[model samples]
Target: MGGMARYDALLVVSFGGPEKPEDVMPFLENVVRGRGVPRERLLEVEAHYQGVGGVSPINQQCRDLITALRPEVDLPIYWGNRNWHPFLADTLQKMAADGVTRAAAFITAAYSSYSSCRQYLDDIAQARAKVPGAPEIVRLRHYFDHPGFIAAMIDHTREALDRLPEEDRDHARLVFTAHSIPVSMAASSGPSGGAYEAQLRAAASLVAGDRPWDLVWQSRSGPPQVPWLEPDVCDHLATLHAAGTEAVVLVPIGFVSDHMEVVYDLDTEAAGVARDLGMRLTRAATAGTHPRFVSMVRELLEEPEPLPCAATCCPAPRPRGAS
Candidate 1:
């Protein structure tokens, strides 16, 4: 019989990015390592870093998390980056060596789509093979609807609204932004059929009940022939500006940590678009090191649940030519 282990130490997993300009393309390559992303396209991703003093905010976010979590839990908490330093293999090797008996993981993403959830498990399993004595690993379920997280988002958006000129606050449209996906995947992707978008919308609804808000996609990449969710943030902003909307508050619900998407896409690309359109814009902060978020992790660790799986989970069609 296979051995069983109790959940002790906690591992917070994230999609890591490069900390310096020189490391950017190599990091992007790690992201799509197996699939061939053209060198030129990877450079475009690197350019996002160039706009922000050549640093990804991910490492700082991880650092804040480690400090916040150190005191509350009995077992050690370690962070492993999927594509960069403090890499998963090294983190797991150290955990095993440190006598970590069992572990529960909290992926930085709040939803359960394939890339967001399952691929993370694949990373852990691969890391375990290289690091002997890995304890039984269990991942915390996605927290899109967790009360405290949702409440944190609500308060953040409300505060962003307060930042606008008092007169414009009422006129400002609440725009919820998340990383984009190819339309082909959206047709069937998510934990249950279309659950990914639904959960996000639901969370947004909690924040903007009677207020005007629209969910839009950002950071699309694929062949020109491929369709992604629309209207893209730029297009959406332009339309709103043309319609005479003056102020906007962007809430990035898809990401749990403040990463490049929040920085580059919302802060840089999205902000630039809004400026050209003559629209005033501000972004709600990503829920980084929020007390509620730490509490959510503590709750999950004290009493755990498996990620949700249904017949429709990962509804993407099986790839062609696979038996």
Candidate 2:
């Protein structure tokens, strides 16, 4: 355990979701926190979870990712989430008890933004503070442009395109979607700013190759008065329909799995829009447990120690009522 022998364990950090009906509201509360998401919005989101029988696919997705990852890396794989069960603090406590001194974290979010990157760092810091002798967590660098991620997405997109009507498959437009952070958050996303959108666009381009595509936003939780990224996926689908696009493949470039956001927002809401508009919309699968994405964890661990984000990078967004 000297130079080049950096860590004892591999931590998989993720945004956790509720696994049952009773856990929904508490989980939502954990997510909105001081961000000032409205009560009405929370209620609406709660209904989304309820409609799906109060289970979010996210927690299971995390479990599956960790299960797939264990066989790939030599180190012990431990998973923790920001919001729900297997909480990061609890996971850290167990790691400490297990005699792990240091670890490399592979956060599920693959890009640089307040929510995606810095918040997870803050979570790790908070969790470590609560666990005596918590392992030093070294977060892996952003992997938006990693070949393994891009390849997984590319293959999924092709599959989605194939799901379209044969006459439309060859001409289907690729529509890449990601969660919409507030405009202010997007403005201050990286060292300089705008790194979130830039990295996402880069990934989309790699996945798209020569195919025509557009990057749109989804799962916007901000209040109506405040602007978030847009046009929202549903609205974008309408725009595509109006533009005479015969078919569209929705690629959720923002998420790594088919969680509630992908399930409720895209498959349910956006897909409804596509149906109403008489348009064909096929959603590409997220890179959940995809072989290359699973292997990307090991690849990241094998790379040189990644530099941490700058202190000024991805500053937190102000609460809705803040002046």
Candidate 3:
């Protein structure tokens, strides 16, 4: 393994989704394990998961991704879920059993937030505690600024815009979205600061430069006492309608695939609001298995060595499994 020696294997880690109805609450409960979201809140979230029959689209997307990415890398690629089956800890155990000495992991999320970025690092840290001679983990550098990814998103955004009615295309307010987290979690998000919004804006700019778009947050959730991002999509849509904004185009630039967030939040929740507002809306396609996306991950895994991380480069904010 020459250049392939960056690691003995490559792991594509992602937020796991429940594949059946009964697993919904348990899966969501795992996600909010440390957050202490009440049973009512968990049930509310589970309600959405159940609406779609409890199957998350992430596993299927990961399956296709692993398939397409095989030719790009020589080592075996393993799929692990952050909150579900073939879990991070279990996957690490299996890799150790399979005699993997050193491995590189690329969490599917492409941000610098606590849960989004460093927690994956923390996951590897926590998992290694129990395993002997665990592979030297090389967390891939963030690629939000990568050219191939930006190009893929750009092309996809243009294509999504084309689907809108002719009259609305020009007037469509461009909306970029990602998963929402507590403001407290967001407070210490960056090795620097505010990289979450910056990376998203950079990605969105690559696709929407001079195209007239507004960056508003979506899917903000909390304990009803604490605050999250304001003017959520529903509020934004109403205000836009009041301003006579007739059409809109949504780009889920924050995500790589049509996970539950897109399917449930946008398709079911936001889409319904737009329909009621009499505003035409279309969402950019999630970059599930785009060639550029696949190639980018391949390039990352193929790098001769890991880039030296600074003291602040994606350091974990809270201890993994701390909750």
Cα RMSD, each candidate: 3.1, 1.4, 2.8
Supply candidate 1's per-residue lDDT for 184.
55
Task: Tell me the tens digit of each residue's lDDT in model 2 across 1-323.
Answer: 43226889999999999888999999999999987789999999999999999999988888889899888888888999999999999999999999999999999999889999999999999999999999999998899999899999999998998888899988899999999988888889989999999999999999999999999999989778888998998888888888899799999999999999999889989999999998988999999999999988888888888788889899888655669
Candidate 2 residue pairs in clash (backbone atoms < 3 Å): none
Candidate 3, residue 312: how far the Cα is off, in Å: 5.6
lDDT of each: 0.79, 0.91, 0.79
Once superposed on the true structure, which residue ranges of model 3 sit more than 4 Å away at CA? 1-3, 308-323
lDDT per residue (tens digit) for residues 77-170 in model 1: 8899899998998998888888886788878888756667667777888998988797667887778888778877887888898888898898
Least accurate 10 contiguous residues by lDDT in model 1 = 1-10
Candidate 3: give the clashing pairs: none
Candidate 1 vs candidate 3, TM-score winner = 3
What C-alpha lDDT, on a 0 to 100 scale, does residue 115 get in candidate 1? 68
lDDT of 3 by residue, 23-95 (tens): 8878887887766567887777788888878888888888899998899878888877878887887888888
Off by over 4 Å in 1: 1-5, 307-312, 315-323
Better of 2 and 3 by lDDT: 2
lDDT of 2 at 243: 87
Q: TM-score of every model?
A: 0.91, 0.97, 0.92
